[model samples]
Target: MGHDRIDPEGIADPVDDLYSQVVVSSGEKTIHVAGTTARDSDGLVVGETYAEQIEQTLTNVEASLAAAGADPADVVRQTIYALDCDAFVEEAYPHVVDFYGDDALPASALIGADSLADPDYLLELEVTAVLEE
Candidate 1:
């Protein structure tokens, strides 16, 4: 038997993306993964840059959706939050492709925020997925 991993060489941290992602799921299930902020499992905001937090939070979202038996395509809706909206949309937003293929995306809404759960929490994404039976 062999092991397979997701995007190993891409992310510098080398940590299993699933550390904050879902690898498998099943059945007709409706899962509500709580809105995940950039805050780490320890509940500490991870970065000062919107890009940093956005990246981590999105990773968590991918995992959570997978755990719910959904893929990026399974997501029917999404919402993104940013402290300084313009900066992210112009700069980091392009990276969204990393979350769910840049070319193919689900219905989504973005908001310019004054702040999030934490000041360092520059960006966060919440999604809804329906697991097909």
Candidate 2:
């Protein structure tokens, strides 16, 4: 849990409540999670809308972090991919902030992908977290 989120003094702060300009993690254990899509335990794609897909995908990310003994607040970096990138940024991005609350949002990237592993898949998430000793 030893980390610092920087917005930098000179740069225009990011408008989305999604990420920081930089994240510095000073911890012994780091967890690298693979990109995860909005698939349920049955391996079925969940949600048809962008918001639902993003929510389920973030929920999956949270589960991955918990299994690794890390919390969302410990996340140092996050990369999100969406098949409908424009809609994701414009409509669905704000929903994630509700999950993370208002502190230490991870340094993030939102990418547009032509497709995911499944045609029904709309969003995927990957994160790196530093576990507090």
User: Of the candidates shown, which would achieve the greatest lDDT relative to the real structure?
Assistant: 2
Best by TM-score: 2
Off by over 4 Å in 2: none
For residues 99-130, write the lDDT of model 1, one tens digit per residue. 66533354556788887776557787887665
Alpha-carbon RMSD to native, per candidate = 10.7, 1.4
- Superposed by TM-score, candidate 2 places the C-alpha of residue 62 at a distance from the truth, in angstroms, of 1.2
Candidate 2 — which pairs collide? none
User: Clash totals for all models, in order?
Assistant: 2, 0
The TM-score of candidate 2 is 0.92
In terms of lDDT, the poorest run of 10 residues in model 1 is 14-23
lDDT of 2 by residue, 74-119 (tens): 8888898888778998767887777666686888888889988888
For each candidate, the alpha-carbon lDDT, in order, equals 0.63, 0.83
